[model samples]
Target: MVRGKIQMKFIENESSRLVTFSKRKNGLLKKARELSVLCDAEVALIIFSQKGRLFQFSSSNMENTIEKYLEHGKEEETTTNNTEVQQHVQPLKHEGAFTAKKIEFFESSKRKLLGQDLGTCSVEELHDIHIQLENSLKTIRARKAELYKEDIKKSKAKEKFLFQENTRLRKQCGRKPNQTPEKQKEIASCSQRTVSLEVVTDLFIGLPPFQ
Candidate 1:
């Protein structure tokens, strides 16, 4: 019995998809090994399932074959026709490029999850990472802004209370015994310093120490 050509698209049925994947994967690996042996060529293959399963093969030591393949690839310019054969023999080489990117993404994420990113990343990678950080920073900044506003409101309230208290104290100072002009000045200076510290701490609230 003969089967008609299957359409090139995602298989909707899980059982059929698995069966096709298994059959094609086996055939692809078989062809790869045969080519390597008969033609005395090096080969490596790598496949990742949509479910993230990995399958791989090599003719010789995988590393040596991969290195040799890369060196040879540099010497030859492969077009579309040759590309099909090249991909068949060394699918890993193609997949490796994408895998490298995926590895970088995961490594970057791992660093962030572990609190070790520390703002060190390449420009392009940093760009994507920046979005995530910017969103986090936005939240922090909003919260910080809210806190600052609240703090400022409290400070204004305190200032109004102090102003009224000072007015009362000044009225009393003239009448009260043993209160001096120098002590009033010192109290005012201490309050000013406290306000300055609050402002400085508020400025530092959402910023990283290094940046």
Candidate 2:
């Protein structure tokens, strides 16, 4: 008699669930034991009840069987990782070779640009090289103009900062907010005299003492 396929679903009733769990757990352990004995193989099984009870079976010492299983799993994982690394490395190796070739080509082109290796170029090639050089020169000129503009901007900012600092220092020194031309000339003369005095002091510092 052919038995119809069972429609599997979760047992919602607590009592029915417990009964099914007990029956299935026992049958699974029995089959594991039978397989271990008949085939002379290491077998292990583990189960957990809904109430958090532990059930387990092993053909030999459970600890040893579990340790061996864990070791086997680690070995398989290591092999898989090594394979993946090799697969990834192969493409990188190919790309490295391609990059090296590209760099060599650019170096050769640079030599041609400097007129160091033009013995093999035809007329058309020479004309193309001339156009490339002209374009490169234009680009360089544009870059230089941009740099000059940036430098001018920085110089203007520095000048403004220095002017503000001078004004602040003058105020701190009790200088009049408005200075006459005669007062400015007097200030400049005083500054020159102070600098000369500092130089004279420095020159005499290393002089020998008179006996």
TM-scores, in order shown? Answer: 0.33, 0.57
Q: Which candidate number has the best TM-score?
A: 2
- RMSD in angstroms, all models? 27.3, 16.2
- lDDT tens readout by residue for model 2, 1-211: 9999856998888998888888989999999999999999999999988778999998899999889989999999999999999999999999999999999999989999999789999999899999999999999999999999999999978866776777778899998554544577799999999988875343456778889
lDDT of each: 0.82, 0.90
TM-score of 2: 0.57
| lDDT, model 2 | 0.90
What is the per-residue lDDT of model 1 for residues 1-211, given as tens digits with 9 covering 90 to 100? 8999878999999999999999999999999999999999878999898899999889889888778878778667556558878768697787888899999988979797455865676777767666878898899999999999999999978876776777687777785443345576899899999988875333456766884
Note the residue pairs that clash in candidate 1. none
